[model samples]
Target: MAKSFASQGDLTEKKITFDEVGPDLWAFTAEGDPNSGVIIGDDSVMVVEAQATPRLAEKVIERVRSVTDKPISHVVLTHYHAVRVLGASAYGADQIIMSDAARGMVAERGQEDWDSEFQRFPRLFEGYESIPGLTWPTTTFTDRMTVYLGKRRVDIMHLGRAHTAGDAVVHVPDGGVMFTGDIVEDHSACYCGDGYFGDWGTTLDAIAAYDVDAIAPGRGGALIGRDAVTRAIASTRDFVDSTYAPAARVAARGGSLKEAWDAVRAECDPKFRDYAIYEHCLPFNVARAYDEARGIAHPRIWTAARDLEMWDALQG
Candidate 1:
């Protein structure tokens, strides 16, 4: 199956859904927009994935207020994407958490990412100046760390690299619900601009082994039942495979970047034609896949200028 995109005419703002995925576990989804996961324990709250900006995060805070007054003590970052982490300060959490790798990615390329993303999607960055600065984590863990929101145990693990080198998943063992950052996304398009396509499959398999009952993907609607969860995983896997495989094959045949992009688009556009942000993501996705397929392990940093250059080179 191909990925879906947001309708160009679908200007309706997404409504937030605060659904109980399990006991003390909730998912705050905005139609097909970015999502935030909540782990409410006996005393406090842990939020997974802050929204894009402080102004945007306030909306999430409003929903969180509907449930508990327990202070949001922790904001966990699943990765170091500007759209995902730049809103950290809005949470007002005493401690911001992230994986060591994620923090490094932020320190290394956070500013460029901020400039690049803001330029790419201006609508998502409404109230852009309200952002204090690049969101930085106060506490970072190497592989795994356990936090107690009062009594509830939330295990934040960097299972493997998928979306980025710093991708992490918030696993609630007892609840059987996992808050997978960009490591997994429902019918939405996967933004693989800074991704490792070959390793992402293995990372996703590790996520599946957890036997999660429900999942809050980085983007898209929440997957409530086992069937829906399975579909989300499979759909994301298929997207990654369909996207990267053709690019890799074309590059292996000594094709130009434009040729590789065209081959992947021919294979993917027909299927994922309807996916949200398919048009927006395709150029960046193709660029990263092309680099990876050509044996460039680390994706080159993408600036605003670089973004346009790549888009122009590949899109036509």
Candidate 2:
């Protein structure tokens, strides 16, 4: 390859920020790295989105300790991505939750994703060896399930598929706060390698309907107010639209992947070049968009070898 995969070259560590997005909701964000959410209820705490590895999860645990002494009773995984779910064991929660579709994807392509992600972004999996094995949810729900953390009502729902086939969002009704997984991102490029462009916006629309006061997004900073939350949702939608349109256009005329790449860059570069992981996400996003445009409904599983092949073809 002419250059290292974009994330492979990203060695600089990001500054971590722990912000309170609601009455007892906290977001642990590290620049554009994967983000985790904390929901402190009346009795125990619930953590959303585990980091890539056990060691990385420890970082989130440290921050959670700073505020509340309640034990983490549950861990919620928003999706099946290795970067988001592999750190499950570290939490030691009594219950782990995911949408039913997420567990299906795990059975389908979990190991392939793990290998692909570990090669693509080494920095995020700082303690890869510490990860015991694939993380599995002890419990799962089909559409929506409500759990009461004491009197605090937490709703976990599969609004629709955006970033992945099984995308779950957590809503804390008391504080009007929502912990949207990758279905919503703030100032970060949506990694659409395994995404559904056709379904993403619809999912975003479902989230906007709630009009929640605050949001703990999948990445970047926490959206603390209605304005910030609205802006993030709009920006994320724009990014998805901008990425898909040009690639779909290229596909419509039976153009090469390289042509689709150029077209997407021309459209997205000026607007999203400064976004976190923009380069890392662009090639895969374009490839998937092209495939989707050509009528491929489901995304192809990405393996380590496939990652190198795609990078070499697109960036070499």
Candidate 3:
């Protein structure tokens, strides 16, 4: 039987875990689903990566309310994926902050991405109708920006591109915690539909340079302690390297996309097939890898129609 598309087969509800990574930082992780980071300050709170919909984000809000009643004054978009954003309105934050590159992506393909991702991950967008519109960032920075929430420093830096052209990391220097959005997944597979495979390792290197005691990744659970954080970074690097290697080799040999994809599956599946979104991401990941192998510097935008066409081309 043919496999279900994207996360359509993943309908079972996962038990959500709200982990305290630092003094006032919380990571809302639901199994291998998209994760959100919460930083509670003395006067206000900042959230990184809004869930797919308003109803979905309410769970995060509920978790936030449990510990501190501080208003969510800021919401950060690590990237422009719909699942990681769309819920900004629900937070009622005074400002939605994102890297300028991310802001450009929002302007470029936010609508198509919203449609594409919503179709891809149905479970993640349970209350899709609740989303008001494209979540636009009110505040945008060039390379790096820092916010002060009652003396707490949260550095939002665009280290380099791994996941997208506009990927950013939330660093809490004082707490030794970093919220890495999809740049470094724990057990979950990396979604390379809009990824930069060639520069992903370099990006990982920059993130690893931080003195992180804990890491709240894009998916899976929070990596608590330095050892787990290190392992997550290493594992993420290994995963990226391993997945792109076969495809790159095949492309260098002037092989077809199918050949490259087959090799990628043969090599990556044994190790990453069981990981979260492994199957759903593999086709897109292979496509990007193949493009990168052929020396494509920037990633092409993924549209809803293109999603089905690519899926059929790969899986059929």
Candidate 4:
């Protein structure tokens, strides 16, 4: 039997976990779902990666309120994916920050992504109706920007392109912790539908250089030690390399997309078949890797219609 298109069959809700990874730093994670990070400064707070919708974002707010009453003053978007940015409104943060490249992506394909993702995975958009619209960052920096929450210093930097063209990492120097968005995942699969395949490994290298004590990744559990952090980064690199290598081999041989798909499945399945969102992300990852190997530097925008067409062609 054919698999469900994207995450349509993933209807069961996941249990959420709120854990402290560093000094006054928290990770709001659900089983394989998009995760958010909380940074409580001396005065207010900063949130990383808003959930898919306001209703889901409210859950993060509930977790935030559990530990600190400090107001959430800033919402930092690591990239421009709808699941990550659409909930920015829920925070009512005075400043919504993103990299300039990320903002450009928001303008280029934000609505298309929202449509495609909503059609692909219904569970994440629990309160889709409440989404105001495409989320726009109030402030955008080309490379790096630092925000102060009273005495605490949080450095947000566009280290390199991995998950998306404008991926950002939030580093807290005092605690040696980093909120690495989708750039580094723990047990979950990396969604490379909009990723930069050739640049991903280098980006991971830059992140590894930080030597962060802990990391709140894009999904799965938080990394609380240097060992866990190192392992997660290496595994993420392996996932990316594994996905791209076989797909690229097929593309280089002038093979069909289906051939590329089969190649990727053969290489990735044994290792990542049980990983979260593995099925949901496989087709897209293969497509992008194939494209990149064939000389397509930029990822194609995925509209709702395009999603269905690709799924049918690859998995039908």
Per-model TM values vs. the true structure: 0.95, 0.99, 0.97, 0.98
Best by TM-score: 2
Candidate 3: 10-residue stretch with minimal lDDT: 1-10
Residue 259, candidate 4: Cα error in Å is 0.4
lDDT of 3 by residue, 21-107 (tens): 999999999989899999988799999999989999999999999999889999999999999999888999999999999989999
Report the C-alpha displacement of residue 162, candidate 1, in angstroms: 0.5
lDDT of each: 0.86, 0.94, 0.90, 0.93
After superposition, the stretches of candidate 2 with alpha carbons farther than 4 Å from their true spots are none
Per-residue lDDT of model 4, residues 1-316, tens digit only? 5556759889999999999998899999998999999999998999999989998999999999999999999999999998998988999899999999999999999999999999889899998999999999999999999999999999999999999999999999998999999999988999998999899999999999989899999998999999999999999999999999999899988998899999999999999898899999998999899989999999999999888788878965
lDDT of 2 by residue, 114-183 (tens): 9999988899999899999999999999999999999999999999989999999999999999999988
Q: lDDT of model 3 at residue 71?
A: 91
Model 1 RMSD in Å is: 3.3
Error of 3 at 255 (Å): 1.4
Off by over 4 Å in 4: 1-3
Each candidate's number of clashing pairs is 8, 0, 0, 0
Q: Candidate 3: RMSD over Cα atoms?
A: 1.2
Q: How do these models rank on TM-score, best leading?
A: 2, 4, 3, 1
Best model per lDDT:
2
Query: Which residue pairs in candidate 3 have backbone atoms (N, alpha carbon, C) closer than 3 angstroms, thus clashing?
Result: none
